[model samples]
Target: MQHLDDATRTELEAAAFRRLLHHLDEHKEVQNIDLMILADFCRNCLSKWLVAAADERGADLDYDAAREYVYGMPYAEWKAKYQQDATPEQTAAFEARQAEKREQKDA
Candidate 1:
């Protein structure tokens, strides 16, 4: 990547991001709690990132718009169609991850 020209690198990055969205779109069964437990991020985090990126670039984007883009539909629609209630195990794992993150931050 360091050897790649900036424009080419950016293009590759964009391609990868698109592929990620497609992958997530395909994996609708993967719940947000699962993602949070494993990676500390979920679709909603991506939406927030999109909004922050837009703000940084002076592009007009709000949370709802970013969420729609990320979810490939309105978030409420996605939640109704696919989101699931977190199992007790998932909830425990997510809580543990949160505690670890806080410990690291404080350390």
Candidate 2:
């Protein structure tokens, strides 16, 4: 890996995060379940991470507020607008993936 200065790395990371958020916003058809099934994380996970990081810094950010920051609107509005019910195959795949992760962790 290239040795990046701290400031440069932080700026790049922030830019990448903004790009990811924009990409997700543009691809509203990609449901959260699909993200979870494929990546083992979703927008909600990002929200939680944001809240946790804030808490670590002695900030009092809540999940709902962090989710709004992540989703670019209230999570309920985003969900109602974009989220779809997962198909049986999607759910099964997600479950199998989770089980595999758990087994890997245990091993």
Candidate 3:
């Protein structure tokens, strides 16, 4: 990063981000709950981060629109096509992980 020019670094970062989005899109079978449980982030997290980034740059970005950008479709369409119901075990694990995170944050 230090060796690269600012423009080149920015371009590379943007390309990497796009590649990550493409990877997530290609792996649609990977559930959000599993991502949250395992990695503490998911597509919705990406959407929220996009919204925040836009706001920081003085751009307007609502939740659904940001979601559409991340999903490569309308949120509802993406959900219908790729989302699946989480199993009870997945739900429990996710809840437990979230609780642990909250506890760590509060400490």
lDDT of 1 by residue, 1-107 (tens): 99999999999999998898999999999998888888889999999999999999999999999999889999999999999888889888999999999999999
Candidate 2 lDDT over 1-107, as tens digits, reads 15999889989998999899999889989888899889989999999998999999999999999899889999999989888889999999999999999999999
TM-score for each candidate, following the candidate numbering: 0.95, 0.92, 0.93
lDDT of each: 0.93, 0.91, 0.94
Q: What's the lDDT for residue 18 in model 2?
A: 89
Clashing pairs in 1: none
For residues 10-107, write the lDDT of model 3, one tens digit per residue: 99999999999999989998999989999999999999999999999999999899899889999999998888899999999999998999999999
Winning model by TM-score? 1
